[model samples]
Target: MARMIVAEMCPQCGSLDVRATEPGWFRIEWDRRDALDGGWVEHLEFGCRDCGMTWD
Candidate 1:
């Protein structure tokens, strides 16, 4: 199971006990054959149950 990192403010009630509802994503990057190969990037989106705020 993944761990949830709570935020400082609740989007809904604007409380301090903001809860993390979901885990976004995990990204891994590797070197290609050349420098022209763009590096890979990953993002994780977290949702707050209080105000339903999501960050990616």
Candidate 2:
């Protein structure tokens, strides 16, 4: 059997139909000369379409 991976889901409606507002991609800087050495991070403000629940 194949396993399914879900990235995000609505907590209120328990629905997979979710949208992100003001999504941003950021890199962690740790006082390093090379910024590439830091890891990449994602910031998302999710909102549920069904229940209109928003969260960071």
Candidate 3:
């Protein structure tokens, strides 16, 4: 199943059109079960849909 993301108010424009974006290639999540191989892989980023503002 896919995850649902709630939009947040933009600090610069005050619009509830914020969305999470992935700018990097990937991210690692340290999990106990995956310790033998490596960490969980993931990616994430944040930005405002209306204003096109991005954050780290």
Inter-residue clash pairs, candidate 3 = none
For residues 1-56, write the lDDT of model 1, one tens digit per residue: 99997556644566564444325423334354234334433434456665677655
Candidate 3 lowest-lDDT run of ten = 24-33
Measured over all alpha carbons after superposition, the RMSD of each candidate to the real structure, in angstroms, is 9.1, 6.7, 6.9
Q: What is the TM-score of each candidate against the true structure?
A: 0.29, 0.50, 0.43
Cα shift from native, residue 24, model 2 (Å): 8.8
- Please give, for residues 1-56, the per-residue lDDT of candidate 2 as tens digits: 99998678987889887887656544444665256534443466999888889998
Q: lDDT per residue, candidate 3, 1-56, as tens digits?
A: 99997666778888788787656544455455376445433656668889988765
**In what order do the candidates fall by TM-score, top score first?**
2, 3, 1
* Model 2: colliding residue pairs: none
Model 3 residue 5 lDDT score: 77
Lowest lDDT block of 10, candidate 2: 33-42
Better of 1 and 3 by TM-score: 3
- As a TM-score, model 3 comes out at 0.43
Cα error of candidate 3 at position 16, Å: 1.0
- Per-residue error at 28 for model 2, in Å? 22
